[model samples]
Every structure is written in structure tokens, then in C-alpha cells.
Target: MSETPLDPRLDEDPYALQKHLGFRLTHWDVDYARLELPIEHFLMNRAGIPHGGIYATLLDTVMGYAGCYTGDPGHKKLALTLSLTTNFLSRPIGHVLIAEGRRVGGGASTFFAESTVSDETGEIIARGSGAFKYRKTRL
Candidate 1:
């Protein structure tokens, strides 16, 4: 048996922030996407919990990917966020954080998506929704 190969684009993601944060694209579909991150002590805040910025990033990235997926997972689409709203619920202390995104609605040029972040133990850390516009050309 062999593991499925990773999307080469992931190695050179246009979003430098994702590469800097070591985000892994675990799954993706036409209207859905999931990203994962292993807990790192350095990501914690003064309260010893994951920073809100981290939560916000998970939400934004996941929801953006949900909008980006065009049918063929191999063809990566670029979606720019027009607006994003996040609601932080709890703090994550688990070894991993999982973010799942689902496309809600929109038309040809734009899209809407919602996403949730949870810990390995199934604790929801945050939820978010966003509006995104597809780029006219590929990056």
C-alpha cells in the first residue's frame, strides 16, 4: 500500500502565511475542505492557550479553501476573501486542531462559506463565515 501523494501546490502555496504556519491540506472537494495543524507550544499566547490569531487563520484558510475548490481538486483556484466573521468559543489544548469548511452559496464570480475549528477531542474552538471572490486569472 502507498499513501496518496500530496498536491505539489501545497509545497508552494501562494499564501505564504499558510506555509509559515505549517498548515496541512488533509482533504478537499468541490464544496468542502479540511485543514490540519499539530499543536506547537510556540503558538500559545500569554494565557498559555492557542492565540486567537491562530484560530482566525484556521477559519479564514479553511473557509477560503471551501470556496476555492472548483470540481477538479487538481486545479487550484484562487479566492480572495471579501469579508470574514469569526466567533471564538473555546481554547484548544489538544495535540491537533482540525478545521473543516463548507461552501454555502454564491454565483460565478463569488462564493460564501462557513467553517469550524475543533480540537482532537472534539471541542469546538471557533466558527466562521466568509464571502470570497474568485480571481479572474490563476496565480
Candidate 2:
């Protein structure tokens, strides 16, 4: 049997197109993916706090990527966030932020994931849970 080569998209920085959006894919396998994002001025709301949408986006991206890890070879899957609930636990005041996500349940076609956004000091600023559906594409 031959080994499948790594997907090139995985090497492309997800945040390269978004200004001030920095993300690092720390770990990923067939069933999981973990990423981190930094909190910058562009990600803040009017109150000088990290915007809720930013948290939502980060959660969605990380969780979606996790699902993609379980998809078939050469078949890319795009995940759509069907529902998401976020709880703001604390204010993140720092130069950097960290976001981690993991698949909690479900399968390759659909799944639920949990994510947390924290400051550099490891204080959680927001927690999120979301349901996503995966669509297989023939790209």
C-alpha cells in the first residue's frame, strides 16, 4: 500500500488573508485539529474587548478543520456552522489569545465541537459549542 501525501492546503496559513488575524495549527490528525489565534486591535469590539463574532469565527474554523481531518482523501469537506452558543466568561486583556477546539461527538458527515478562547495567561475569555455539517466537494 502507498501512503497518501499530506494535503497542501494544510500548509497554507489560514489567517494570511485576514488582517491582524494570526492562527497556528498546533496539532491535527485523522480525528482532531487544534489551532490558536492571537487577540489584536482588529479583533476587538468598541469596548476594547475581543468581539464576540471573532470568537465565533475562531471556534467555527478550528472545529471545522477538525472535521475535515476525518474526511476522505482528495475529497475536501466544507463545514457550515448550523448552530453555535457562546458564553463570555471573562475579559481577555493581553497581547495574544489562544483558541483550542476538538470534536466531541458525531461522525464524518455531522458533528459537534467545543472550543475555548483564552488570553496568553490561560484565562478563558469565551467558551463555545457548535454543531456543524460537512459537505463533500470533488475538488
Candidate 3:
């Protein structure tokens, strides 16, 4: 499969958890983020389906990133999730899973975001929403 061109910032320094999950940051922009993951055996459960925790992790990560876009790479933005909710809609059927997130609304210090996980067929398998607090950055 041809690899998707990802945002360069993703390679700068990813957290260990992100690397371990093996999801790629395919896109990022103002109030938006998109990630993709190839289904792997290790990510499946005993029932041979992707684990629920994996879905939650992807949802949280994407949503948080949706609100973290800073036009300037040097000025990084971070957010701490205050609350997160994931709703599994259906089981996915495909070799790859795609997650997309969008920032909804909030003030400067806090924000809200929503996300969905979809299969290669474009069927949404999971949905999520979250509230986050912007972290203070050192001047």
C-alpha cells in the first residue's frame, strides 16, 4: 500500500505511547486532525477485533491534537484532557482504520472537540467527544 504523506511535525518528537500504537498523523490544521492506523494482530482482542482501549486512545489523541494546532512550529501548544467520552458505534471491517477530529467550541483556556473512527469503507465505527484545558507554556 502506498503510504500517506503525513505532516512533518509528527516526526519531530512523538510520545512513546504514540509510537507504540503505530498510528500516523496524516493531517493537521486549524481545529482539525486526522490519523490513520493499519490493523495489526497485536492490536486485536481475543475475539479478533480491535480492542476498545485502542479506539479510546486514538479518539483522545486525535481530539487533543485537533485543538493543539499552532501555525508556528516553534510555538507549541498542549492540552490536558479534562474529560473524554467514547461511544463504540459498530465493529470495523477493513485493514486500516481512520480517525478524524474537529474542535467544536470553547474559551481560550478550555476547548471541546469531537472525533470519529472509520473503516476503509468509510463507515464510522466509533465516536468521541472531549473537553480539554490548554496547558501553560513557558515564555
**Residue 4 of model 2: what lDDT?**
43
Please provide TM-scores, in order, for all candidate models, with all chains considered together: 0.86, 0.77, 0.91
Q: Write the per-residue lDDT of candidate 2 for residues 16-103, one digit (tens) a residue.
A: 5443577666665565666666666777799988788887777777777766673454555677888888888888767677677778
Which window of 10 residues has the lowest lDDT sum in candidate 2?
Answer: 1-10
Ranking by TM-score: 3, 1, 2
Candidate 3 regions exceeding 4 Å error are 1-11
Superposed by TM-score, candidate 1 places the C-alpha of residue 79 at a distance from the truth, in angstroms, of 0.9
Give the count of colliding residue pairs in each prediction. Answer: 0, 0, 0
Clash number for candidate 2: 0
| Candidate 1 lDDT for residue 27 | 74
**lDDT by residue (tens digit), candidate 1, 1-139:** 1234435544334368776777788876668888889888878899888889898899998888878865553665898999999999988767899998999999999999999999889899999999999998874
- C-alpha lDDT of residue 19 in model 1: 68
Give residue 42's lDDT in candidate 2 (0 to 100): 76
Task: Report the Cα lDDT for candidate 1.
Answer: 0.82
RMSD of 1: 3.5
For 1-139, candidate 3 gives per-residue lDDT tens digits of 2344655755446679878989978888888888899999999999999999999999999998899988567777899999999999998878888999999999899999999999899878999999999999722
